[model samples]
Target chain A: MQGTVSVLTQIKEDAVATPVDRLVAATAPDMARVNELILSRAQSHVDMVPELARYLIDSGGKRLRPMLTVASAMLFGKGTGNAINFAAAVEFMHNATLLHDDVVDESDMRRGKPAARMIWGNKASILVGDFLLGQAFMMMVETGDIVSLGVLSSASAVMAEGEVLQLAKTGDVSTSPADYSEVIRAKTAVLFEAACQVGAISGGADTAGRQALSQYGLELGIAFQLVDDVLDYGGQAGTLGKNTGDDLREGKMTLPVILALAEGTAEERETITTALGDPDATADQVSAVVAIMNRYRALSRTLDQARVHARAAQRALEALPASDMQTLLADVVEYSVSRAY
Target chain B: MQGTVSVLTQIKEDAVATPVDRLVAATAPDMARVNELILSRAQSHVDMVPELARYLIDSGGKRLRPMLTVASAMLFGKGTGNAINFAAAVEFMHNATLLHDDVVDESDMRRGKPAARMIWGNKASILVGDFLLGQAFMMMVETGDIVSLGVLSSASAVMAEGEVLQLAKTGDVSTSPADYSEVIRAKTAVLFEAACQVGAISGGADTAGRQALSQYGLELGIAFQLVDDVLDYGGQAGTLGKNTGDDLREGKMTLPVILALAEGTAEERETITTALGDPDATADQVSAVVAIMNRYRALSRTLDQARVHARAAQRALEALPASDMQTLLADVVEYSVSRAY
Candidate 1:
């Protein structure tokens, strides 16, 4: 972890030019350590948990959480032990959530491969997910940092609660933007905020620094989620890991449709409702709904809002010292919304 | 936990003959400590994890794992801190399983009241279950007892595998008895065996002592599960915290029904098929199945096998020194079976 931190610090010193290069340099070591911990801890047994976890972890995924942790820590300095451990911890928690999410959603694909539940069965996915969550909590305890434990636990609880709320709201087309925001805050932003805040703590930053990083992460996460929702319509179905209209098929009311229903012309809103209202809504219907959103620029408008939040995330990081990690943090804000299929 | 364990130990002493008094008295202190440690650790979190734990722990349960830990220590006469910790560790693992189970089973009642999922929803139950599992791992790491960790982890993994297997077999009357046994061993017996075997490690028991305890716990667990199946068939729902026909309703094939289906008269087998075969079998159909089970004496025959296993468990305890905890262990075998409401 220390070596990883040193590499991050070196990146900050050597290159502060392009956002992508600086970001890659700052986050690569942290991501490597996170992956190492995951591989080592997850390899102890091959019976079920390890087998199932390997199927998912090996599935291609960008190490977003660890990057945020490293970036947050770099707000002060990159060479911090706390930052590296927390990075690993956040990734563990995120992976655990993914495992459970697949089971709950009855999803069959993720990250361009069959989901853990699809391959291992819901039972294996659920149990292995539990195992990983336990592992994450253990990691947090190892830091002997009570505040970190408190923050992470609270965030996890909120995440689960948001899931419950979402479950209750399924199939309802009346999902408001506020409700969408709450769900994102609980399900997505909380962890993002926690990752950054934990980084701040590791860097010996004050409460204000912690809050700023947390806000930055929260905004970034929301923007990321918005883009994901947008891509569900615009991106190719095969690569997104599920059917493009899965949200409609599974009764998931994401932001793009919600905005269209609220503000689109009546014909477009009707089109959106027709697709969302049908439990077994067809691809053509879903495509029609997407086309209607395009016609009214509802999808584009939502992207604009996401970009605003992304810019806010960048401005928040501007308070940090000029360094490669800081530059990377700013770059991630843009990347969050500029994601491609 | 200490209070509960000591009270139970006194009951064991009073229940057993003079032969077992010394063992119980000797084991009481460690059990007491383990109970305290587990309770403190389990209930320490005031929010998510602790809140859910208290709901279940205070709901009334026999702290069997901690008792096993202490008894093994006393029987082996090894004084070390590790044993008590293992005792607590096993219980934590057990509780983690329970939390997830309630969610999966969609059980409303636990210990005569609404279950964790009933009050908090499946999502909370699932997430909190994740939290407890993680906490257990955290606590286990504290002991630095690798053997115990390996045992707990393996048992946990197998338990999950068993659950998955059981799920696969649901609503299928053609499930073989061997498959049922495998599921049973994975789901229940492994943990019981693990709890006792880890106790042996703490007690400084030789290979023979550990093997005896391990086998004893395994047999006891089988008996316990058999009894549970029996109760599920005809016992009072109030006592069971679930409806009598929950298994049939949930499409589970237990030992009794499996045994009966293989050998019952053709008419009875047809009845079993009609009641359990259809994917959408109704409540009336389930009642018919239970009636058929009665005609075939499935409950009686199953109870007899359970009794045999209980007797085997008692015999397995012979090598251990006479003690109150030991007597309680013997009585537990009988008590679990005789628990029919």
Candidate 2:
């Protein structure tokens, strides 16, 4: 793991560009180990295990959640041995949810490629998801920190509950912004919160430091997901690696849709109701919904909400001593919301 | 937990009928608490969670795994206030696997009722299964015994790999007997083994005592699953709560089918192949497959193998001191095999 970290650090020294890139470079020394552990733990004697796991794990995602864990650990400048395990565990949990989510959503592609479930059947996807989750818990248990284990395990249960709640609300135009907050909190933010909190614990952070990082992660995750929800309607399909308006087509009651429904005219509401959850909805239909969102300023309002979260995430860092890592974490939050622009 | 135990014991003194009943009665003093914990921990704020989870948890399986944990703990006459949690954790793991297994296998019914996936759909089934698993780990973490947590967590990973390996082998005639052994040892026995081992540890048993109970549970679980495979072709559909020969229809390479294929003539092999994994195979086709199995004494041989495992389970008990719980556990192994008779 240490070797993996140093090699990545060498690369980073040559190329420290974006805020996230800078964060990655800053934590490269720890993240290299986390990356190596993630790959090693994903292996199994069963051939399909690695085959399906690598299809998703190797697919290029930002590895942002694990990056938060590693960064949060390093923020305290204390070298506890458990941070790598926690970071890997967080990645496994994220990937596992993705695997099962694809199956649940009947999604054909993820990360600009066919989903693992698309290549392997749903059975393999579900089983491999279970395998990843099991591995996640195994990693946590190895940490031998019962408090941290409880945090991760509890986050896992909340994530599932959040998913189920979102599933139940699918296609329901009456979903409120409050309900949407609960959904994102459960499904997305809890994991981010857990990743940071556990990393803080591993880093030998005091109680105030742990709480601060937890708040930062929670607010950042909410902002991240909010922007993602907006991107589905406003961004280019290629940029998101999915067609624009996928959330609308999938009946996902994200904040943009909820805001539009609450504020739109009856005619606009009828337009959304006609297209929402319609798998066969055409590009013209998606355009119609976006136009309604534009008329009501719902898209901008959603972005406004994301900026609010991003700022809250930045404010969370005020609990820590001023440091370059803290400034970078705050900058990353700004960068996250800036994507909507 | 102690209060719940005493209440069940008060009732058990009047009822000790069947072998499992005797085992349950002997362990009822502790198992009552495990049962309460199972129900309470399975609950969730997400309405769909408790609803789907209880649908399976309440479906009236014997709760054999938790009972084993309780019984193993009792065998040493020690209570560290952890067995109840471990027992509940074991049951959660068992039910979680069943929920996911039903989805993977596309099974329609379980425990003589509609499978959870059948009623809740695969999405809910997959998510709820994850929720239960998360809760299982949470329960273990509450015990604060990191060693036992590692034991259960590792076993969880192995069980998932086992399931995937079995799924990979489905419909493939080339699956070796050694491969089959690996599958059951992982998917089925490892949890039983972990349950007993953790219980012994929590019960203050020494390393030797823990190993004894682990071996006992392992062999017992192997015998139990072997009998189940045999019953899939031979037992009444009503008794098994599914169709006879479901394994053959699903192309599962159970012991009888593997043995028959290894020993059958080309013509017989052709007949078996026609029906294997044929979802629409008629009773006559199943009968033909059974006739081939009978001619080769495959079913009898499988039963003989189960008896060997059962005896081995009993022998494992000799490592511990003589006690009524030990005697009941030994008898329970015999009873598990007697179901096939």
Winner by TM-score:
2
lDDT for each residue of candidate 2 in A1-341, tens digit (9 for 90 to 100): 35434644555466446678777777776777888898899899999999889889999499999988888887885434899999999999999999999999999889999999888999999999999999999999888899999999999989999999999899988888998999999999999999999988999899999999999999999988988888888742213234887888899999888988888889889999999998888888888888878878888888888889899999989979987678778988998887877
Q: After superposing candidate 2 on the true structure, give the runs of residues whose Cα lies further than 4 Å from its correct spot.
A: A1-16, A78-80, A235-242, B1-16, B78-80, B235-242
Q: Mark the regions of model 1 whose C-alpha exceeds 4 Å error after superposition.
A: A1-22, A44-48, A70-86, A142-144, A202-209, A235-244, A265-267, A277-284, A294-296, B1-186, B189-223, B226-334
The window of 10 residues in a row where model 2 chain A has the poorest summed lDDT is A234-243
Highest-DockQ candidate: 2
Global Cα RMSD, each model: 8.1, 3.2
Over B1-341, each residue of candidate 1 has an lDDT whose tens digit, in order, gives 35535665555456443323433454566656766776687553224556777787778476766666666665566534787777777787787788787766666777788898787666667766665565566566667665666677667667776776776688677889787878788889888898888888887888888898998989988888888887877752222233666776666889877977887788878877666635456666666766666666777878888889899999999987776556666866776777764
DockQ, candidate 2, comes to 0.83
Model 2 docking category: high
Best by lDDT: 2
